[model samples]
Target: MIFDGKDLSHRALADRLPSDETHVFRECDLTEADLWGAPLAGARFESCVLDGADFRKADLDGAAFTGGGGMRIRFNDADLIDASFTDVDLSSAHFGGALLTDASFTGCRMIGAVLTGSRGTGFTLSRSNLTLANLGGCSLRGLTIEGVRFDDADLSGCDFTEATLSDCRLRGTRLLDTKFTQADLRGADLGEPDDAKLRAFAGAVITQAQAAAILAARGITVL
Candidate 1:
């Protein structure tokens, strides 16, 4: 029971059994609240305004949701390990089976968010604006992303082995079976791809203008 920076306003705590395990509600607003089973670990909804709230099975560890506009919030089976979502909007929000380890989404909006089967580790989203984000089966192996801007993202079965996407923008992205095998797609832009975009940087271990802009966008315009 570590209630730091307390201010629990508009509290409609439902399914209550977690009698003050860790109810911070820091910088609180807790809009349309219904905090179910709130035994939330180290819970600190900082700069809060948890709109349409219903934190099911809450045990959010190291919680710190910086800034507000938390729309339609509902973190099902939440454990949110190392939780820290800065500049939040979290549109179409839903964190199913959440236990997001080392989670820290900076400058967050998370448009069209639906993080399926989430089990993150050092999941950093810098310069964030994941347009049409779905993030299926996220198991980012060796992940260390920089300047993130996943434009039109789906990233099917994502497991970027030895991952390090510097200056990323996989345009019209939906890279199924996504694994830049031995990753480091440096200065990535994929040359304005649109022709049924199927980006599978085969045995990818990049450089050299990112393999000459993915072989000059598959047109192989004789470099």
Candidate 2:
């Protein structure tokens, strides 16, 4: 089923959807729409306004979300395996208890998004703004993360073993119990990491400039 340019705001659309067929929604205003437990597997949502839209417990595996999006959309406990989100504004979106394995998020504004307690092997995040987002206890092992910003975000207990971060920013990011064993952080801007934060990157590889900066911060002059 295809719904184009439809205003589905504040409507209960779970019962109206067909489970046997995949749906496509383009340029639709789905703000505050209730789709809890809806069977939306492999659905495509393009340029849709999803502000406050509730997709809790929805089956959204392999779903594709592109272009338009709004703040505070609820996706808690949703099944998002292999889902792709590109150029979407998903700021403050909830993903607690959601399964996000193999999900890819690119060029998205994910500020203050709560990804803690999300159950999955892992997900791919690139070229995205994740400032102030909470990704506690998440495992990003062996992933190549590029052009992402994690400024002021909480990364407590995250596992980045052998992960490569390029052109990334971790300014003021919380690294409590975070592991970076054998990770490559040569291209990341790890702004003034204190003793605890520096210890978090013990086994990680960094550039000479970063080392110089770290030493310079402690009043050490490097030749």
Candidate 3:
């Protein structure tokens, strides 16, 4: 149902929803609503404010959450296989322990979003803002992360095997135990890493200037 600018409680909205099926919630204010353990697979939520809403353990497979003003939304432990989130403002949202295999998030503002322990094999995050986001222990193998901002983000224990990170920002980002095996780092602004942080770039492709900058940070005279 189209709930443009309408504010409804979780119980009220849940009562109106059908059993174990897809539902459409457009432009609704579901802020801080608790939808824990709900069966909402293949549901579509467009331009809705779901900030601080709890979607823990919910079935959101093949779901689409596009064009929303939601920030700090919680999707902890949710099943998000093949889900698509486009143009959504999910800044500081919690996706910890979520199953995000084959999920896609394009043009989303995900600054400071937590993605720790999230399991995903295939995912695309294009033209998104992930600055200061936590991606610790996430295996992002072969993912296409174009034009994304990763400044000050925690990438500890994260793997970027064969991933394409073109035109991305990595200034002040934490790279402890991070792996970038055969990954492309062309046109990325990986601003001046120290010797310890330089160790994280062992198997990745980089520019000559980047190499010199890393060496300069290590007290080496780069002629």
Candidate 4:
């Protein structure tokens, strides 16, 4: 049972679904719905309100959430490759080990979200607040993040190769073993990183003062 992108009510569409992905849901408001373990790949949810919806282990590859409002939604271990989320409220959301390659998140408010071990190859998160988020042991190459506040966030052993972080603030953020080879961090406020972290930020694009500070810690002053 699939509607051809036509307008349909939540009650009307739920009555026609086949308890699986065979029934396509287009542009419907599934707010607070129990959609756990649903195979809804290639489904287009335009401007849907999925606040507090449970999407644990859902196969949502190629899924599109445009102008969304899905706060506190669960996506644990969900396969979300090529998924695009615009204007989504993802506060306190958890995405552990989720395959998020090529995912685009624009104008999303992800305050205090937890995203550990999530693979983000070619991911884009513009204007998102990842403050206090746990992103340890994650790969984020070819990704672009802007206006992100990572205060007190755990970024240990996380890879940031060739990534762009504009206007990002890492105030007191944990960078114990983060890898940032060739990553651009211009205009970013990454206050006082440790020795191990300073080595990782050696080749990263940052202010000359930050580089000097890092080198100065090694007893090699640039006169």
Candidate 5:
């Protein structure tokens, strides 16, 4: 079923949707729409305004969300395996208890998003702004992260083992108990890591400039 250029705001369409067909919503306004437990597997949402949309417990496996979005959208407990979100505004969205296995988010504005407690082996994020986001306990192992900003975000218990970070920013990020074992952070801007944050990066590879900056911060001059 295709819903193109439709205004479906503040409506409950979960029960009315046919479960046998693939759903496609393009250029639609779904603000505050209730889609809880909706069977939306392989669904395509293109340039849709999804502000405050509730998709809790929805089956969104292999779903593709492109272009438009808004703040505080709820996706808790949703099945998002193999899902992809590109160039979307997902600010302050909630993904607690969501299954995001193999999901990909690129060029998205995810500031203040809550991805903590999300159950998945891994997910991909690139060219995204995750400032002030809570990603505690998330595993980004062995992935190549590029152009992402994690400023002031909580990364407690995150696993970045063998991951490669390029052109990323980690300014003022909380890295308590985060693992970076064998990770390459040569191109990342790790702003003035303190003792704890520095300890979290143990076994990670860094560039000489980063090492110099770290030493310089401690009042030690590198000749």
Candidate 6:
């Protein structure tokens, strides 16, 4: 309940929030703050800036966004269930149509974050950067994307069933109509995928130099 230089709305910051513990918003700036439909469950936003903050339909269940850097933060249609974004930067953050079940983004940066049509399940993006992030049509089923970068990311029509993408980078990623059923792309760096983007790596579990860089970009000279 420390709103320095206050410009309160959200029912006057939920009547000076202190409904039995856990509401420490240190270094509070809350730029463009609206906090629409605010409840802010278990809130603790350390080093808080919250640039362009809206938090539409906000609940923020189990919220804890340490190391404030909430650039372009919106969280459209937000609930953010089980939220815990550590080392947060959240560059260009939006999270369109957000729910984010079991959210836990450690070491987060999230460059160019948008997350269109978002709906997460068992989320846990460790060592996250999310470069060029869009996550188009996201469902993100069975998520655990470790060491994530996702360079040039759009992830068109993302589903990622049975997901466990370790050491992820995915350069030049668009993967139109992306599903990756039974996904487990070990040590992933899936670039050079021609032949119509290798059919989105069906039943994804690529290795062997990403199948010789997707059959040498469809030249098919793999020995």
Best by lDDT: 5
lDDT, model 6, position 178: 86
Model 1 residue 110 lDDT score: 77
- Measured against the true structure, the TM-scores of the candidates, in listed sequence, are 0.34, 0.99, 0.92, 0.77, 0.99, 0.34
Worst 10 residues of 3 by lDDT: 8-17
Q: How many clashing residue pairs are found in candidate 1?
A: 0
lDDT of each: 0.70, 0.96, 0.84, 0.74, 0.97, 0.78
The all-Cα superposition gives candidate 1 an RMSD in Å to the true structure of: 12.3
Which is the winner by lDDT between candidate 3 and candidate 4? 3
Candidate 4 local lDDT, 14-99, one digit each (tens): 23445455445455566667666776777667666667677777778988776666677788888899988877778778888788
Instruction: Name the weakest run of 10 consecutive residues (lDDT summed) in model 1.
Output: 190-199
What's the TM for model 6?
Answer: 0.34
Model 2 TM-score, all chains together: 0.99
Residue-pair clash count for candidate 5: 0
Task: Please write out the lDDT profile of model 3 over residues 1-223, one tens digit for every residue.
Answer: 4456678545424446665556888888888887787777888888888888888888889989989857778899999999999999999999888999989889999999999878767567899999999999888888778899998999999989888788899988999999988988867888768654668877998888888877777789788
Candidate ranking (TM-score, best to worst): 5, 2, 3, 4, 1, 6
lDDT (tens digit, per residue) of candidate 1 on 1-223: 4334444446766444364555555566777677765666766566777776887767777777777757768887788888888888887677777778888788788777777667656466766677778887687677777666677778787887878777768777787777778787766675464443435666767667656665677778645
- In Å, residue 175's CA in model 1 sits off its true spot by 14
Candidate 3 versus the native: TM-score? Answer: 0.92
Clashes of each: 0, 0, 0, 1, 0, 0
Please tell me which model should have the higher TM-score, number 4 or number 5: 5
Q: Which stretches of candidate 1 lie over 4 Å from their true place?
A: 1-11, 20-33, 40-51, 54-58, 61-71, 74-79, 82-91, 94-99, 102-111, 114-120, 123-131, 134-161, 164-169, 173-213, 218-223
Off-target runs (Cα >4 Å) in candidate 2 are none
Task: Candidate 4: give the clashing pairs.
Answer: 157-177
